[model samples]
Target: MAEQWWRRPVLVDAALAVAVAAAVAIAIQVAGEPIERQADFLAYALGGLMGAVLLLRRRWPLAVLFATVAILLTYYSLDYPGLAPAVPLSAALFSAAVAGRFRWAILVAAAVVVGGLVARVIEFDMATLPVASAVITDAALLVSIVLLGETLRSRRERVEAEADRRVADERLRIAREMHDGLGQTIAAVNVQAGLADDVLDKNPVRAREALQVIRQSTKEALQELKTMLTVLREGSETRQPGIDQLDELLDVARKAGLRVTSMTSGEPRPMSAEVDRTVYRIVQEAVTNTIRHANATTVTVELCYAPDSLIIEVTDNGTNTQQGNTSGFGLTGMAERVSALDGRLAADFLPDGGFRVRAELRT
Candidate 1:
């Protein structure tokens, strides 16, 4: 229900300019001419109208300048000094400069001053010294206004751009942390839960072992989450995971009932953090999808590392029933995550009545 600042009226400026213009025109008419004359009456009215237009100088600066200039030129040519037209032009020049168009403001100011000076000199045969001095003063004032405006505009734009970059960088950092910390913790939990389920009916000792692993995994996950929150609040942390942890990740998935086969054909090398994480997440999500969606008795995950690319494939022999799929945000989120790393993810029903998901990330 709050009104926007931009929509609010800036009436004070317009009102002040109009009042000044009206006073000037009234004073001139009272001293030098009869107020009853049509010319004097029209001059004062036009001057007040042109001055009132200054209120819109910030929003429609160029338009305001041209309109004010045209009105003033017409009134001055018609022999009426009622509208002190120079004020609107000065406001517009300053606004334009602040909006980061200094060159344009300077060009307009130059044209106006030069033309006004030439016209006045040729028409009135004015002395060169005074006319040149006034023109130079006006030109200098316009230049100063424009320079000030440009400086402010540049500073504000830089601040906004820096803020945007920082926000984006923070989001990316958070995303990587969540992917590694939460994903690994969840994988360990899944492994222990599976082990517990398998031993619940037969061996009490094995079941307790699984439960202990689950407890440890949960504790680690909590610590990671807490660390993440702390980093979010305080903006510093020394603990971070990298591609070196991929083996432990695979071990966790293996415990959870996925047969993961990882091989590096190329020389072990470093990759960008984004690409490394993308590879890890793609594999993780693919394996998770196999467990959740494939009712197969066996799932196979393969990771092939080449010189310039990492290929990952998750295939399951379980033929999950082709029932109505009412929920699948994980796959959608996975696709988005992969695309953000400039990779492609493909999921489909295998011709052999199974499901497979594949992704390839360029290092």
Candidate 2:
């Protein structure tokens, strides 16, 4: 208990102030001063009392300032050199300023300087220099300290905001990938299963084939989902989704219902995972939109690979309900995803009643 109590700043400051006061008292005694003088004893007692009260500066800054001011006034009035308690006074001022009450600190600082000046002028002493210097130095130091604290706080806030933005961006990208990849595959499976169910009694062999395709499509989707999710949930930040299985993805769409015709141009080559994933995603979304929104039922997906870029296009005959409450969020999400990858995406409604989506990803 004793060790912990002494470790506290308030307790340590109080102890030091008391020690200085005692030293001052001893000096006065050694100067052959009359100890029996009532005024002299009273001054020494007031110094010790004021120093003790200063221990509570952090807990009660205003009270500490009030007590220190009173002590200074009493000492100056009585001309008691042994009662000079500048240490406690400075500590009280610093504590108030650090407590984030700058206006109050300024008011107290002004009052101290003015009162000290008035007292010194009355006493006709050279002590005014020390008092004035102490007041100015303490105020300046306190102001700088507070300003530094605020600056660091602002910097921390900015760093936190940047971190939040990065996280949000990553999450949005993940959602877009999941939607473009898993969403399309799942939708195809649903369509194939529904068709098989309707045709099972009339055409057993065709229905069995459709069911097989559905099973294979869903299994592939599961594998792709696992791979993408693993990259997202763990490993290095450089990990990305790529299109290593484009043929299988397209086959699933073909089996669903839409007569999808796909053609690849230029020399096929390996590309960056991010770019590959983006190509697959754009095609997947385009195909899904064709299935869900088109009426004429014929869809074509073309991938024109050039030396520097890959061009993707999906066009379908429009016959579905175009004016219905459709979730256009998928289109909006696709645009955001493509832009992040430095790609361009465009969607158009044909005057002849068809829809088309074109995307170009630069290498």
Candidate 3:
């Protein structure tokens, strides 16, 4: 898609150039002293040139500032007009400051003010031009213009930084969603595929059941993926799996060959969407890890609700070969999710012979 015509940089610069040129030319004609007929055209030419130099300000701000200052100084040196020093130089100073050249803009403004005041003292009598008053007024006006430009630059930078932060946050949310949603489904599918391969000829009925589980797991995974994509593409909220879906989640694990059971001991109450999603992800990750790494036949998921907190624990009676390697992405993501809600997570080996994951989330 094309950028709006007014928003295009080239078009904006062209408009600014025309405005500056007109302002400079009008300032000269309105305030300039009478000069020779031919010299008036030269004066106007110099003013237009000052404005024209601004067209390149974005690319070479310092150069443009210097060029505009040189043109203004030349116009005044020829005794063309007694225009205000801040008027013609304001645009250039602003451009330089906005381009992050604040020091250069300040130095140029100071030099112009000092040089112009000294020139006026030398050319006109001190009585004719109130030298001190003129110097004070001109210096204040130029400083204000530079300050304005610097303020705009700072504001623009802050806005850009906030935008970048939001983009990063959105990306991280999407990643966590993908990991939680698809990781469990893929692990179940892997287990079912292995079972089907092992019993393909020897136990045709078992193999068929395993294949059916694989088909269902894949279908669920595809549906979850499509839902996530829809949320990303349309910027709409989709129903995320929560504690209410635990039954279906456990059933899937059972179909994949793991005898999974869940028990809730707390008085179930409504939770915020974020907390609900986090709780589901915690259990989902725990189960997937049990299926993949903890070679266990039976798994138990427990949910205990207290007055101010919700506690979840998943334990499996399996030979967890990867017990020491609990720092995988799944656990790390789970820990982050728990930590985000000011909660705590513990993943350690049980005393007897299994692995356990426990999380406590504050309501």
RMSD of 3: 2.3
Where does candidate 3 have its weakest 10-residue lDDT segment?
A: 30-39
Q: Write the per-residue lDDT of candidate 1 for residues 1-363, one digit (tens) a residue.
A: 987654555755655566656665665565444433345567777766666777776777777667767876777677654334456577667777776667878888888888879976997688999898878887788777778888888998999999999999778657756765576567557766887898899998988888877787687678879978886887664433445766776665565556666655546677776676666666666665555556555666666777777777777775776411415445665677778778888888878777777887778
| Residue 227 C-alpha lDDT in model 2 | 78
Best by TM-score: 3
TM-score for model 1? 0.55
RMSD for all candidates, in order, please.
8.8, 7.5, 2.3
On TM-score, the stronger of 1 and 3 is 3
**2 versus 3: better lDDT goes to:** 3
Instruction: Indicate the TM-score of model 3.
Output: 0.92
lDDT of each: 0.69, 0.70, 0.85
lDDT of 2 by residue, 1-363 (tens): 357877778668777667756754664455443533434677777767666776676678778777877877776566555333445555566666655555676676666666656655665465757767765775565455445544554676789899999899888777776777688777777777877998999999989988887888888888878877787768546455456666766776777777778888998898877788778777778777766656447888888888998888888886665612358557777687678778898888878877888888888
Estimate the TM-score of every prediction. Answer: 0.55, 0.64, 0.92
Which candidate order results from sorting by lDDT in descending order? 3, 2, 1
Give per-residue lDDT, candidate 1, residue 103.
80
Residue-wise C-alpha lDDT for candidate 3, range 1-363, written one tens digit per residue: 988979888888788888878877777667744562333788888877877887898999999999888887787667677554465589889889999999999998899788867776886667644888888887888888889999999999999999999999898888888988888889999998998999999999999998888998999999989989988888737677788988887877787688888888969899888889889999988898888888899999999999999999999998966853855578888889999999999998988999999999999
- Over 4 Å off, model 3: 1-5, 34-39, 127-129, 323-328
